[model samples]
Target chain A: MLQTPPARPGMREDEVDTPALLIDLDAFEANLDTMTAHLAGTGAKLRAHAKTHKSAVVAHQQIARGAVGQCVQKVAEAEALAWGGVADILVSNQVVGADKLARLAALARITNIAVCADDAGQVAAIEAAARDAGIRLSVLVEIDVGMGRCGVAPGADAVALAHVIAASPHLRFGGLQAYHGRAQHLRRLEERHFAIGAAADSARRTVEMLRQQGLDCPIVGGAGTGTFELEAGSGVYTEIQAGSYCFMDADYARNLGASGKPVAMFRHALFVLSTVISAVRPGIAVLDAGHKAVAIDSGMPLVWQRPDIRYVGASDEHGKLEVPSEAEAPKVGEKLRLVPGHCDPTVDRFDWYVGVRNGRVECLWPIAARGGFY
Target chain B: MLQTPPARPGMREDEVDTPALLIDLDAFEANLDTMTAHLAGTGAKLRAHAKTHKSAVVAHQQIARGAVGQCVQKVAEAEALAWGGVADILVSNQVVGADKLARLAALARITNIAVCADDAGQVAAIEAAARDAGIRLSVLVEIDVGMGRCGVAPGADAVALAHVIAASPHLRFGGLQAYHGRAQHLRRLEERHFAIGAAADSARRTVEMLRQQGLDCPIVGGAGTGTFELEAGSGVYTEIQAGSYCFMDADYARNLGASGKPVAMFRHALFVLSTVISAVRPGIAVLDAGHKAVAIDSGMPLVWQRPDIRYVGASDEHGKLEVPSEAEAPKVGEKLRLVPGHCDPTVDRFDWYVGVRNGRVECLWPIAARGGFY
Candidate 1:
């Protein structure tokens, strides 16, 4: 059902198979510690988004490093994490269908499970599933802070949905899910600041409305790798759902920090290790990793440590790198590390992550929740 | 390790879980029959690309309906197809690493297996693996033929690689793999014809060169859904590797035929069925299907049977649909069918394909090689 691990323990980096997802364990551990230390006593707990890494092994590491719990987008992901022993899980996105809600409720027996709803009908569906399963499921009323994707309106409409969940015997009102997803990639610091500022304002109003209805908003969750600091400092968001901080991608590295440098809080830990399968041409080389291996939704992957070579184009299974004439062409079978443009979907492409340290394979972790999209 | 199937047999279409991949059985059957009838006596055999639909069940169906065999891009895919009882498999792309080549060579014991190579180093690596595995492996010299991805130069370079394969004791020179990948998506009929025309000329010369070297070219494989007819018509190509015809995507649907209409050869047989999880805002709706559910490399998905709605944007787990003011907004919990922009990566996202016919799920097929990216 899954491909074999690209590298085994004790193997050198060059010996690992091409198109394998490689994690720099040193940088990965540094990111975990850095993020944990940065978030300590910040008033906002880190409910690290499992949707990025999609690995229960990584989730356990994050949990050990002071991450309060894990946040996922699908019930199947929750099931995977729970089965992998992740006790506190939240389906941060909306869980719609009865089949999925039932699955979510079923996990509540062994783990503390929570899901989001943006409408009365979704609340009804979750309620029915929880009631049928004889479980009390935590429900988060997701308010559209600014993303314009999911969630209900912020003020009265969100309060109304919260009341519906409060009225359901099988459901508990968790709080507001005010995620500004688009702001996470806004490149400019000012753009992100403005976006999260508006998002925080909307979430604050929604919380007030809910409090006016005699409901206590225990959790106001929203944040990603790029904007977690803004939300953490906003005093409104209690839970920061920053996932990519543990595995920084090329897109996140492009974001300008307050100090005018690429966000340096986390180091780039994730890489798609590929081999130059074809370099017969003069100034062009092809890699085994392409769209199928590393996602290009953000843009083409950056050739790590090779400034002269640029990933120009990609087909399904091949990525074309434009090599400068002055730079030596990578010979056939030569391996290179590629920083994926996006981490989540790139991580979704593989079953195993070969964790490397000092150019040697140190660990092979199964992406337990990989492709858990139901 | 895979997620549970979204739907079981005998379930209605609406009852199926959201973000599930659906196969319209009727259209799928039509595509198979139409492709078979079109390729009958064309002198080129249909070697359906398994990379498009990584299901051994689908591979068997294609083989049963006159396909010569299946073509894959990865060794794991070949292994999966062979283990699923596919007797013949060609890795249309290069198998780079020694580990991958060893796995491919191991498969030669049970199934007729072949792989592509461009460089002398790759040939040497494959020869080493085949020799170590004690198997005579078939090797194809992939010529650029204008794809500019993999493959050697057309005439002399291809002949030189073919000779290298012929000289190897464990390797046999199969033929030329000259796939014009970019030409497959040419919007105009003239553009595709021109591209494939040049590709055929190059392939024809390469074959002549191989023959001049006293090597018999057993196969000259190329062609995809968009240009299969041209390659089948060309006297030089012995095999048509058209895979997307089995499940036409939105990108392929946008290609114009000779008659100035959408290429009507293949019907849209695959769709991502998603539930409208959020519709609280006016003129906006959100679906459970997004980048994780459907690939957006080609473009955003098309709303099947809903002309008034447009899939405008997508995040990781949510798709935003822009609805016309006059059109009825899709209510929460309403299911909609989405024709994926690119079918290959979209299919790779799911573990199961729910086969539907006449508004009911008739079969559940496991995508046996869903994540076969080695």
Candidate 2:
């Protein structure tokens, strides 16, 4: 169910309910403009990943600022974007079951929809669903590029899968999906450069192999917030699908730059706005937000702008904060912004993004694809 | 938004969509019956935590089998239950803000509603909301037994908060809320025995203090799936708040029995039914379910009934499995059941529960409070 919106348009940030997803509009728009400036002449277009924001509002904002389209991971996300009038979307991950493919195919009529395939059986399944929907769906061959979770092997294996996609009755060969997800969080600049370099080598080899078969690759999509600049400079990747760049998190903020310092490419725009609901002792305080309201898979959330305070632990609905002293303890009903360790899954936990600018709620955008994980 | 139901009643279990929440109805019902039998002659009533299942259907089942009421961690959960005909409900955690307190007070008009307080300021806020709503709200003093997340100290502090609740015109002192959350996962039976022993001693001392202050605890609530037997056997707790007993997860399954084996008190009735989306080579495969679909806070989910395959890593939309060899590889489009690491947050990620019995889907229960983390 869609949750009640946590804030009204003109309410102060503190008046907004606890455990709300907050976006600092100043930092958020700066991040988007920063990305636009960075990609101004890179010869690579931005296809912002919707799996991070999950909102068609955010997708449209990116598109208005020069993003080519949006990329999603689930068919349900594709549906939400299509329903919200996103002109083009790519399911950057595989759509496995017939039920999911049918849902994907139905959206092809409303928007330019594409999906990835790593197996011939899946290509056939996509074809069948497209045929059932009486629509020709664009299918991309995902090649393994260090991120071993999904995708076929890069050179010959990828070309063979592309052939299967081209031979399908109701499918169009959309190109290659080579995303090195592990390379995104590599702490060292040299380490990230090396990983993306190898990923680009694999993609370049596969493109050459596809050309040998008289096939022209229309799109070669990959890159993330941490390594978009590297992929853009590689002169190979056509689309930079960087999602977290627009909402920098603590995990992404940890990525180092060429100077061996934490990268400041993007500002931390996302926060879990939580209230100090309990303060039993001097140095200990508890926030209303927990792992249920914020993501903890990367690490525990950090107390925003308060180096003296640390989020020590999380239960279902409580975030324990360790303060410096009793004299400076957070009072009950005090609101604090928490920098979530991960931005993607934290956004998944919320239904509304309380867009705040200058300490006031400016808008409430529905997290349209919040629970559409299927 | 509520998601489309993954399966219809009468459909085969395998025919359901990938990454769907499945409940083995036979196992689920047996779990309910087992809990009923455990507390049958113990004089302790079950008030199963709705934070685990988040379904009114499941709560109704528990109540029909002699559960006194249901407990939730948030006002949104209490609202979901009250609207769904749960006559008696308790907000087992502290509700901090005025907005949340107003929502909770509004629900009191429909059902028997109560909330918890650990701070004097919070008690005053609840009294104001109750006064505004023209209702006498029941407020429980949450005492810290062992869990350091929330609640005041056990004896004097708890009695003082209860006094504040009793002094308020629009609020009534409900009882004592002393839940030991961490003790629920103590692996060894003896460790669990020791932890709950301390917890029960504290609760007993507090109850005595309240009685000496001319107060009575109508509900001395504490205990979970791991230590409910100890709390019930303590002869002091009137309510057992065991939520995961009806839908056991992998973490709870790790609790040891008296003979040093995994306890077999409750069956594993919950599963994240996921499809193998990609299986490129031997020893590695990927599923459609990840931490976003099924939680990984406690640990990575275990492959149900598949001792050979292990879930190793999870990205946003993919769960990577480490299998043995190509001879027994998980094929693309093959369905697999995964035992989630935690049940509460896993249940929070979905909007519907596909209940299956005898290999067919028997019902579809709406996870009505799915995104109601407020």
Candidate 3:
């Protein structure tokens, strides 16, 4: 019942129509290469977070580019990647419910699967599910570095969880998941450096504590698109889990690098192709991409290639563009590309991503991990 | 394959599971009855906005409750309602491309379909589509009623469009669409009153101008969940188009009535059922519902029925809740519901709305119009 997959593969961009999800393949490939080259000789492996791409095609491309594996935040997302033939995956988060845990255990039958646990109860749940399924589950102990959001306390508490994981017959102690979710978008270079510095120290201490307890850390993972360099440079973090680098968003454009320039690791590959529906005022025009078409969590959508036009407001069915003084407003029937403030949630809004290269439709990738909330 | 439907026809709240859409049938009915009662003696009619519900099931309910027709913002939305057996539909916005306009005109073969036009080009396009389909398409002249978003000029410009509509034998004049979208979110009653007052003045002037040329508006539709009362009371707006009354969200709570109290016309029923996936800290817990489950375009989601616990921040896979120092944090596997900031966009995030009434799985309804981005 998908009316017509937004932009089918091999179709031209103009032929694909309006209000479609467009991904610049060249920009996307460049992003993949940039991340791969940066993490080339670094001992840390790149398990590019699939929760960002949510497409098997993208995962396959990343793997071909030399990523060690893929990391997913949900069991359903893992199922998508695994079904797409991703050989290795880490369910970078915990699976709680019996039905979902059973589903996770089933995935191990097909791929090298790993998951994390911050609590003893979750460890026991994973162990029981694995035992019943007659499969060994690779379980990591998540340690809270400084995000204060998810993970066990970074020192002795993390060791205790690691012990619980090792003691389980059906579970093997993986490593530490010390992720500072807040540091990814710290804006200033010094702020991100300080945040990652504290996070690296916390993770180093946790790994050291585990070693003292005779536990070998196999996979110390934690990093995002914003701070992968910081985590990869740290000797303790063996795995870099950056997701949004493939399609950098406006929020990421706010981050500053060491040399004080805005970090430009990735190009703006994703955009919402919208059509001008109404021209109400001299300097105000409304487009079809609105709250439903794009995600505005980080901020309003940026008018791609149109610095003079500002996407000032949005309703359910309309996006209001504020025309700069002395600038000609967009006429009705014109098409515009809107770069979303946040890329992850914005991708979830559409059912398909129209891959456009050189102004022609190259491919249409389904948002397979869409609605993997359960 | 479709995992599940958006909602169920006959199910109680508890049986549906957590984070499902709960339609308070009583409140829903009351809202419809109130609208019907308000427009009973008045010559004006009700064209309930379908952009809010995006479901033909709800559209049918509104039609059964004395509504003359249903109005949707997009052709895809209109098609879903029309396919669901709604006889009369007004696409309250313009359709741009040939594919979409053709789709709009094709619906006329199955139902009484109309659309609004703010420009001559759009009017000509609609006329061409109607002629091609051999159908008489009703066209509304959208006037800039102070919402600087969409519409033609209020005076001669609108009258000129009406004449354009009159010129086409296959097209009929169908009044003015003068929706002030910003006025819907105005927190103060007086502000909304002033906004709608200006809108009504513009519509009235347009109607008078049309009358000078022997044209009478058959309909004047515009109003939203927030400012429906203002437009309904304006004496000029013939049709009250409120959509969110069926599923109120956190944004509507910010709206105040004339008495300065939070508008209590409808109860909050829509929510994202999320599970406590991680308890990383003693006074903090992370839920599975994050940016993907709930939208933050208007603002962050509120913890349903739990004022003490704050939804402090959100990531793609997690919503961080700050538990009160004295309060017990949620354990892993516990479920909580989040009241979304904006229901329409939040609902668009899900493929299905698990409709639960009392308890036990009763029935499921597919979001037939889900991903209708066009």
Candidate 4:
């Protein structure tokens, strides 16, 4: 049910099919190394989020680069990573249903599996599923740090949920999940610093409450690409859940660093390779990649190396580019690379990633957990 | 790899997994019949757009109910539909790359394949590929009927391209491809009427120009769910390429009809079924479905049948809903249905469609062309 790879190893970049996902091997490796080196002595380890890449191959690479484990959003993602030989997997979000909890519990036999919960009913569901599957499950109480999306209230409510998990015979209390999702794209470094500061405070108070109840919070996991440095420096967060740092998206690049410039910690490694399919007009060209190929939830994609050409509009499968009067319009069949506005959903659009280096294909990796959204 | 189905054939709606794509069979059948009956004797035939559903099973159902063929945006879609026994397929957009054109030409062995082009260079590329494949490929001259996308200027430019295709030995001049994509969501009925009126004028003039050049325009194909009535009444568009009418989206629901009310032609049949995973607070609840499960390109998905709850925010795997103070908050594990903002990309997120009727799973259909975006 999957499409074939757009290009094979050693093939030139121009030979790859249009609208295929391309990973710049040099930049990708540099990004991996940069993040690993930055977090070397920070006292916090990387639990690289697989929800961004969804490729077990990428997860394995991160693990080999000193990531403690892979963080996933769904039970199916945990299954995919486990099947691909990932030893430790955490479902960073809540797993609510019986079918999903049963699947998560089943993974415990092959690897270390952990999940998050913000409610007592969710704890009961996970405990029941673990008991029925005859396995022990690690459960984390997700506290509402600052996102106000998911998770229990910061101090007392989170402690209450942790006590429920600790009392269950088949469930083990596994610290806190305090991800501030909205803060990750605050655009200014000061805003992110303040957001993470409050998040860390909430998480710290919750941990103290848990400890007062005779419970130990082993893993205080929270952080993303935009504010990983703040959480890593706080001495509160133990596991960084940074995902998009592996392949910087256009939206993340728009964020300001502490130096008052665009965040430059990670290079743009992921791109949607497209072709100019129509250029009949003088100042207009159309690309084959649109909403289905690259996501627009954040914004329109940026033309990788062509500042003269702007992606002005998009339909279902066509992206319209406005060419500058000073620059010549791109001809038909001309190839271009687009830095996606958002990485996660754009990565979900493809089955394989054409890894390229120096204009040649270096590797082709299958997106094993591409659409594992259940 | 694809994830497991959210529900089996015998499961109830509540028993289905969270974040599953669902098709209400009753509403879906009504939508299908409404479109079929609306275009029964309107002179223009229905060429259902497969880009919306991406399921050959749904395509066969559309064909069985009197659709002329299936319209796709990618060659991979044509391959999947052809493999699933769809005989007639039209790639309703421009296909430029040599690899994609070759694949589209190869599918002519089992299906009647046609594609669109707006440039002389694209015509030469398609001619070369079809010549190499030893097949007579049908080529349509796409005219830019005010969409400002991938098409040539109306009269002389379209005639020139049609001549280029007709002059090629391996290519047959199909007709004119005139689609006003932007006009589909104009919100006001008069705006759409004016847009379609201008599009039909451009198409009519292009057809006349082609006739002057001794070419007969057999298939002047254009029109979507939003403005199919105007194009069908225009006497120029011979085929109606309405895709989203079978599974109306929330964006389309916002469009106004001639009577100054929400367009009531089609019922909302497609939905993303989600479970409340977090509800610890007074009015805020979080759902399991987020950007990965539903596309937010057009807008946020609406909570079906819950006017008091508004989907205010979304992260990768969580949707934050704001409930009214007068209404009770949704409890954990409570199932809810969401009408996706955009039907095409949202349908592209899932692997299977859980067809439900009377609160029970009626059938499970694999989305045969879900990720066929190559």
DockQ, each predicted model: 0.74, 0.79, 0.60, 0.79
Error of 3 at B49 (Å): 1.3
Model no. 2, DockQ: 0.79
As for model 1, its CA RMSD to the true structure in angstroms is 1.5
Candidate 4 lDDT over B1-374, as tens digits, reads 86678789989898988789999999999999999889878899999999999888999999999998999999888988999999999999888877888899999999999999987878999999999999999999988898877788999878888999999999999998898989999999999999999999999998888888799998999999999999999999999999999999999999998789999989999999999988878888989888888988899999999988999887778898999999878888899999999999999889999999999999999898887877
**How does model 1 score by TM-score?**
0.97
Docking class of 4: medium
Model 4, position B324: C-alpha lDDT score: 90
Query: Predictions ranked by DockQ, top down?
Result: 4, 2, 1, 3
TM-score of decoy 2? 0.98
- List per-candidate RMSD values in Å: 1.5, 1.3, 2.1, 1.3
Show model 1 residue runs off by greater than 4 Å.
none
TM-score against truth, every candidate: 0.97, 0.98, 0.96, 0.98
TM-score of chain A of 2: 0.99
Q: How high is the CA lDDT of each candidate model?
A: 0.90, 0.92, 0.83, 0.91
Q: Provide the lowest-lDDT 10-residue window in model 1 chain A.
A: A94-103
Compute the lDDT of residue B225 as modeled in candidate 4.
Answer: 92
Docking class of 1: medium
Give candidate 2 regions above 4 Å deviation: none
What is the lDDT ranking, best to worst? Answer: 2, 4, 1, 3
Candidate 3: CAPRI quality band:
medium
